[model samples]
Target: MAAAKGAGTKKPGRARRKNRPSPRERLLASATSLFTTEGIRVIGIDRILREADVAKASLYSLFGSKDALVIAYLEALDQCWRNDWQERVAELADPEEKILAFFSKAIEDEPEKDFRGSHFQNAASEYPRPETDSERGIIAAALTHRQWMHETMTALLTEKNGYPSESLASQLLIFLDGGLAGAKLTHDIAPLLTARDLAKQLLGAPPADYAI
Candidate 1:
């Protein structure tokens, strides 16, 4: 009777296996995970393929080459981050709250276990002076995201919040860059907290009392 009952039950594992991600999806997932945690240059295609359990042909067919894969990874990262930030601030009515929420999300959303600084920043540093087309693509992918963030913040501060100049937005960008570096160096969230407080002061928002 036990054997009969077991035979009648559907296998959850089989259902999950049937719904597994495609080869391209698997390759990107592996590349993003390894590249973010390890690095863009340090991790090779073999390692990504091994981790992804995918074939070389699939990678080439999907991404063309390793450099292309890196570009795709950065592009995906950029999209996910911007989408998440927009979603994070969507419901908030206050423009200042929306601005401050960016910093808050950085602190609250990201896990510290294997935290690395911004993937874009890391990739840009890894290829300091881009020479090849692929290198340029990689750097462009990184800078484009930063540029979008800068423009968005500037518009919010100057146009929406009645800030006199765009300089405040630039300063806030610097603060965020410095804070990310500090947090990456120290493996702590203190720097992010400090950055948020500083941003609040700049925005003339109510002061937060955080000791870091």
Candidate 2:
């Protein structure tokens, strides 16, 4: 009957519980938390496996190696960060809002999130070797994040104030990168606020008051 048929119709694929994440997701999730909270270099494969509740074989089979895992984490973070910023600012149609939203969220969210600042920056510092593929991947990921900022500023500046994207984008990139670095060093969000306010003025918006 219908009830019997329904009871027999168990969905396929590993029979995971409602709340449980898959092995791959578990590995990535565990690494993300650890790498974000603690720098990536100090953490090892055994710890990541233990935290993820997965086996070493699973880690090897799923991610190949520690370096790959780290690279995956950074690349994922970069894509997600950019997408999240876009979604956060989707409601505000102003190009300037799209531009400033990056700094505003960094100012507001970073502190509440323990304010480690840029994952790319952290990865670059952690993996300094240019020879290895995974290490080079770290550098590439960091550059990709910067490239996104550059292209974003370029488009916004072109649309809003009729300025050349190449020139203004470079300036904006400096403020953003420097602001993040200084904010991390000082444990203060004031530099980001200053950057945002300065950007507002440059973009022809009303100047914001930035007081720490």
Candidate 3:
């Protein structure tokens, strides 16, 4: 039988369309990609919507507002790090070993997209003042991550390791930020490797040879 006129016709050269991701997944995937690839400050909400292929109404309904959505993204980012690196470091019996392991993970090559530096640090640099944005999501996210780092470092260094937690924690964070920046600029992990060695030295451990 001949195909009827106006019937659906399949062509060999036609491409199949992928099933659309759920609206929430689409939004997260799009926001993360754009924010990481370009920057949070530079990427606008409308652009995010377009990339997500979701309507403004959907985005608002899902997140309450743009700020809320960004906060969600930040939360996701934080949880990812905690699960990926911090949890594993907890397995070490020595608190000092835990501290070194923290920095060691940073230098180790994880299966991930090209290095663009820490997302929290990048957001902080882009939006240092809360006044810069009306909702202040960016500033809040940055502070949240920093507080976590402070708490973790303080616990390991002071409670178990018998070091001055306050000063050392601050110094370690400074080194972390510096190493992240240096790695992004140089496209080499040596800065982070060096930072780990410096951290060991600060803890009174003999500095190990750091490699690229």
Candidate 4:
């Protein structure tokens, strides 16, 4: 009772792949975590690769260089912050309140410990006076975020809202950045609170106490 030769042979089993993020995603996530916690200029590609558990060749293939990866990380961060801002201001009825919500949300979201301030501002500070394409790209991404906030605030504070000055919106944007920088320096959200109060005064709205 001999079995058939071909029938008795067993087929080789295929390897099962784990459910994990793609190399690009892992690299971005690693870069974002390191860049925000540590300065972008200080964190190198090797660190990012080690954190991401990805290969050097994969990184080079996907991003072309460390600069490209930084740009991708900044772009991703910009989108995330924009989405958070939109969600924060979505439910408010007053355009002015929506603008104010940005400040309030910042206060609420900040943990007061290891706070790193705005990613765009950090990137801008690191890449000031860009000379190369990558440097310019980095700065452009940062400025894009700032420009968006300025435009959004301008629309919110336009003539329909009884405030017609785009300069005021620009001022508010500066205040937000200033407050964030102060918070980073002081390791407290008190500066942001001050910024919010000043913004209220500027908008001629009654000041509400914000406790962090």
Number of the top-ranking candidate, with TM-score as the measure? 1
Candidate 3: Cα lDDT at 129: 59
1-212 per-residue lDDT for model 1 (tens digits): 99999999989999887899989899999998898888888998899999999999999999999999999998898899889888998898777787787787778754553558777899999998889998999999899988888888888876555544456678888888877888888878899889988987877842231101
Which has the better lDDT: candidate 3, or candidate 4? 4
Residue-level lDDT of model 3, residues 1-212, one tens digit each, is: 35674366665444333455788988998998988779876888899999998999999999977777877788888888778766777567787787777677777642154568778878767765567353486678767887888788878777654544676777887888787778877778889888888887787742231100
| TM-score-better candidate, 1 vs 2 | 1
Q: What is the lDDT of residue 65 in candidate 1?
A: 98
lDDT of 4: 0.82
Note the residue pairs that clash in candidate 1. none
Name the regions of candidate 2 deviating beyond 4 angstroms.
1-18, 205-212
Tens-digit per-residue lDDT, 46-69, candidate 2: 999899999999998988998889
Model 2 vs. true fold: TM: 0.84
Q: Give each model's clash number.
A: 0, 0, 0, 0
Give the Å shift of residue 172 in candidate 4. 0.8
Candidate lDDT (C-alpha), each: 0.83, 0.81, 0.75, 0.82
Judged by whole-model lDDT over C-alpha atoms, candidate 3 comes out at 0.75
Model 3 lDDT, residue 35, Cα:
81
**lDDT by residue for model 4 over 61-177, one digit each (tens)?**
999999898889888987887898888877877887888888987787666436688878888899767899989998888889888888888888773355455777888888898
**Worst ten-residue run, lDDT, model 2?**
203-212
Looking at model 1, which ten-residue stretch has the lowest summed lDDT?
A: 203-212
Model 3 TM-score, 2 decimals? 0.78
